[model samples]
Target: MSRTEATGIRTVLSERLLQFAADRALQTREFERRVAALPADSPARASMGATLSAAKAWEAGLLWVAWRLQPRSRIGA
Candidate 1:
């Protein structure tokens, strides 16, 4: 593949990853809202909170990978 083609594909993949990460963040927020409604000391609340932490971590990793996939500017372009 040509350089242009490779760059285009990377751009598309990066955009999709960003979109996915945004969607995941929204879902995580909703989960947090629901979890907050549960009694603070409820076992289910604790369990779901743990799951929420995992979701947040996954989202962060996705964002990091997407950022890495983005095209970098040339120093003297």
Candidate 2:
């Protein structure tokens, strides 16, 4: 593929990955809200806490991958 085509594909993939990361962040926030709403003594709270932790981890991984995929500036450009 041409350089222009390759760059366009990378840009599209990067945008999509960033969007997915954003969506994961929003989901993690919703999980946080739910966990906060539950009573301290509730048994479901423990399960919700676990779920929240997993969600946070997933979001972090997505964010890291997205960061890695981003283009870096050249030193002398």
Candidate 3:
């Protein structure tokens, strides 16, 4: 109910959101590497590509939610 508690909760949520975004980015990078190392005709490469696309989509969604949750004053800066 207190302003301090509300800010604390927001901070924690922001940190967790950032962490999730970072983790997804890392996973996407790894998937790209795996896809690159696979043969051109490999079915697994196609699967990895799809996985990477999904990871990027998830990251974008998280970023959008985080942006919406941020304070108005902090949104543009």
Top of the candidates by lDDT: 1
Specify the highest-TM-score model's number: 1
Pairs clashing within candidate 3: none
By TM-score: ranked, best first: 1, 2, 3
Per-residue lDDT tens digits for candidate 1, residues 1-77, read 99889889889999999999999999899989999998878989878978999999999999999999998778987
Q: Give one clash count per candidate, in the order shown.
A: 0, 0, 0
Alpha carbon lDDT at 22, candidate 3? 83
Candidate 2 residue lDDT tens string, 1-77: 89667767767777788899898788789878878987899998888888888888887887787777666557986
Task: Give candidate 3 misplaced runs (Cα > 4 Å).
Answer: 74-77
Clashing pairs in 1: none
lDDT (10s digit) by residue, model 3, range 1-77:
99768877887787789888888788778878868988999877777788778888889999888766664455665
Poorest 10 consecutive residues by lDDT, candidate 1: 38-47
